[model samples]
Target: MFQYFRDSNNSKNQVSEFILMGFPGIHSWQHWLSLPLALFYLLAISANILILIIIKQEATLHQPMYYFLGILAVVDMGLTTTIIPKILSVLWFRAKTISLPECFAQMYAIHCFLTMESGIFVCMGIDRYVAVCHPLRYSSIITESFVIKATVFMTLRNSLSTMAVPVLAAQRHYCSQNQVQHFLCSNPAVTRLSCDDRKINNIYELVLAWTITGGDLGLIILSYALILHSVLKLNSAEAASKALSTCSSHLILILFFYSVVVVLSITHSASKTIPLIPVLVNVLHSVIPPALNPIVYALKNKELRQSLYKVLKMNIKKT
Candidate 1:
């Protein structure tokens, strides 16, 4: 479609930078978006950082669960940082130019952290599974060493898998139209601008999503299935209720995560009919989880709540 605008010089096929179109048909009020986006950025960053600090300062939070939570906070921060800063720049200052390498880097980081989040969710599901289904071996199964290994493996696996997305995107010959319609450098959005075919990119993305996110979803479902079985066999209604309650927060988080994802995917496909929904969903998907994760844990987990209270008290005393 962009063939006429294709780079004529064979020697310089790649564009140096791309203009990120923050939002379509709303440039007049784009500045108004800065307030909420900035607020989300602040909340996500501060909440994640606070979670990390409290986990570090309180030795009581040195368990495997907290370790995983700390890692989740780190990933959430990375995920938010990947897009929000650039988004704020676009909305606040109309500075929308992003270098090719920088765009690719953002794409890579977003996918990597997203995949890492999925991996962490799977790990958390497994942690819950062990705690409920195999109480005697919970400690042995999710030790400090195991956490380290799990973190390393998750990082490595996702890094290796997600690297291809940016690599493939960078390889594409982007011609005259260098304006990206979306806020972030998403794979499909970037690929759509290319003069060349993106069949491989599309297929690879589908396979990757199904393999990583889809597989994680499957494992989570299976884990909960076994958990339900164990809970049901408890014989006592109170015990069953308690066991189900323990999974509630994780379930809520998972539901929000996947629900947004599914809705975004659907909206993207039908975007011509409903143009603004996908953009809003895309922005929310990146921001809401990070802002909510710490709050969820703080509200739902007794240990984290007490530690947060202690941290707050200490800060209050300093004043």
Candidate 2:
């Protein structure tokens, strides 16, 4: 699958394909990793699909919170799908060589979906804030139209911003070093292999990361802070507890998602010494939170659980 082109000035060949090293220093045991990864991928895909179906089927779940949840389900599936299959292929079949175009596409999809997920988290936080802080105005503020607009805005914002990462990466000149030392075509992983000055790519990625993920996280934190203040002012402990419970699942999802991301970033810095850790963390980030998201929501949400039960009961009887 390797293609090459001669540079105009130099006779050196430019790389047009990349080899994905799934997990460095663990080549012998790499195939063993496939089963668990495949299971997690299946679980993530199925659970998110189930969440979408339940949300669509249950009239009671057609509210702002559930609408955001549905969007999140879609994003989670996209995020996992962007990389897991290729990772699995690398592990199971040793099909590690990826063409330039495919690598760039994967890079774009992964970052785009990641940013979209962050945006959805921000939207969910806003929904919770409105519901808790201004109960009477919740309906007016978080209507279907508001949901539609927020979804559209989130999709466009992340899509356009994340596109720049891969676009910049594609413009770089890749020489002989085409081996991406990661399962998927991560921006840094691929860009660092280019035999070109990566200062601009590095700076843009840093600014983009802080702008999208950091900015979204900041907004989510502010929304929760306001929610906490309003919940505290409630006269009854029951009201406060109820409001907190409503946010608990979201908080858990946010913690799991961002905590892995933080760890992954940290490990990347130390990856020179502990190379395997970052790759493992990257796989975990792509799989674990996504697999657990729907399960957490279903367990925490009484209405969703009941709806799921009703659906299961009907399916069982039909069988």
If scored against the real structure, what TM-score would every candidate get?
Answer: 0.94, 0.94
Best by TM-score: 2
Give the Å shift of residue 93 in candidate 2: 1.5
**Clashes within 3 Å, all models in order:** 0, 0
TM-score of 1: 0.94
- Every model: Cα RMSD to truth: 3.8, 3.0
Q: Give me the displacement of residue 274 in model 2, in angstroms.
A: 2.0
Q: Give the poorly placed runs of model 1, Cα more than 4 Å off.
A: 1-14
Q: After superposition, how far is residue 309 of candidate 2 from its true place, in Å?
A: 0.9
Worst 10 residues of 2 by lDDT: 1-10
Colliding residue pairs in candidate 1: none
Clashes of 1: 0
Model 1 gets an lDDT of 0.86
lDDT of 1 by residue, 1-319 (tens): 1121232323344666888887777867878888888898899999999999999999999988889989999999999988898899888778889877777788888999999999999998998999889989988888999899999999999999998888777767787778988888988778788998888998898899899999998999999999998998998999888878777777888888988878887888887777677877888889989999999988988888999999999999999
What TM-score does structure 2 among the candidates reach? 0.94
